[model samples]
Target: MKLVGKTAIVTGASKGIGYAIADHLMTHGADVVITARNEAELATAAKQLTEAHTADKTKAIPVAADVSLAADITRLFERAVEELGPIAILVNNAGNSTLDLVENLPETDFDAVVGTHLKGTYLGTKAAINHMKATGTPGVVVNLGSVETFGTTRGNAHYSAAKAGIDKFTEVTALEAGRHGIRINAVAPGAVETPMGQDATTPEFTAAWHRTFSVERMGRPADIAKAVVFLASDYAEWITGITLLVDGGTHLRGLPDYADFLLPTTN
Candidate 1:
């Protein structure tokens, strides 16, 4: 129970990587306020989390909100404070993407992708830092980035740009918040099996991904979740402003051509 008294707010926690991060935080004895756009899914996740950790007295409160909206973000933080006291951790894990070449991608699509990944990070981090500073709490913020920022395949230009911006945003925010006893960092994950990534889990794609990964296996949500716990815990008290790649060394080889797998005839 490294975080027995701490409270965390995890955006996009209704499922996938976000859900895993919230679960791991609760495992380590932190109260978590999980948010997602889907109210039903968020409630379900909260129930499961609460039931799983009843022995530890960990609370998983679900708030339905769109992370890309500043008003919603503000309400999320406010709810957390009201229900669980001051926030000690914030995970900006909400994301969205549409597959299309830059030439064909729509402006609204670009904005939507960038807004959720980049703008959401900014808004959530800003709110968390302000709350922490006011409460005299040395909190931590972890932004969910992606290996696409470093090695991206085609049709992911918008995602790459947004994640790359997150990398820099983490650094700049850390520099600014460090003096106030706040630490900010990012975690970049490679291909992970999740509902959002179901389209990429075909046999051919799985084989290619396994061959390309140095670990010879796909990443699990728990893998990334464990890393987040480490960074959020006191073990990393001195760490800040770095993008930790939990991609199973996928960057060392290269990202598999997602288009090749999704659109076999396009090539």
Candidate 2:
């Protein structure tokens, strides 16, 4: 019960990495509010969480709201505060992807991904900070970033840009929030196996994942969730303004020169 009595709000918690993070926090004794755009899914997740943590220690609430919408974001925060008390931790995990070449990308695609990844993080952090500052809670904000911030993907320019923005934002927020005893950090994951990961599981994606990753297989959402718990815990009380890449060594491998490999070789 490392997080006993702590209150946390995890956006995009209907499933995948977000859900996993919320589960981890709840297991460790945090009262969690799980937010997502899908009402049914969120409700189901919240029920499961409550059942799993039914020892009278942790609690979970389901909130349905689109993170990209300002109104929805506001409502989420307000409802979270009402249910869980002043939040001590926030997991800004809601995001979407726009995978395509820069020229082929639609305006809507850019808007959606950026709105969800960058703007959503901005809004959640802003709302949480206001409450934290007022309550003098010295909270923690964990932004769900991506490894694309470090490197580029040929077909995912927009997603990469938004993620890169998150990287910079995380650092700036951490530096500024430190004085208030708040800790801000970014978790940049690569090739994690989740709904989003499965969506990218074409042959092209498989090839790319294989070439860039040193690990035998794609990463699990649990991998990222564990890191989040650490950062949110007093274990990493001194850590801030950093982007931890839970990418199974993909970044360390660096960007591979795939041009040569793309060419057909006569067998």
Candidate 1 wrongly placed segments (more than 4 Å):
265-267
lDDT of 1 by residue, 1-267 (tens): 399999999999999999999999999999999999999999999999999999888989999999889999999999999999999999999988887777778999999999999999999999999999999999999998999887869878898999999999999999999999999999999888888887445888888788778887789999989989988999999999999999988899898887887656555
lDDT tens digits by residue: candidate 2, 132-238: 99999989999988887777546666778888888899999898889999999999998788987676456665676777787867889899999999999999999
TM-score for each candidate, following the candidate numbering: 0.97, 0.92
Cα lDDT, model 1, residue 156: 80
Runs of candidate 2 with Cα error greater than 4 angstroms are 255-267
- How big is the positional error of residue 168 in model 1, measured in Å on the Cα after superposition? 0.5
Tell me model 1's lDDT, rounded to 2 decimals. 0.91
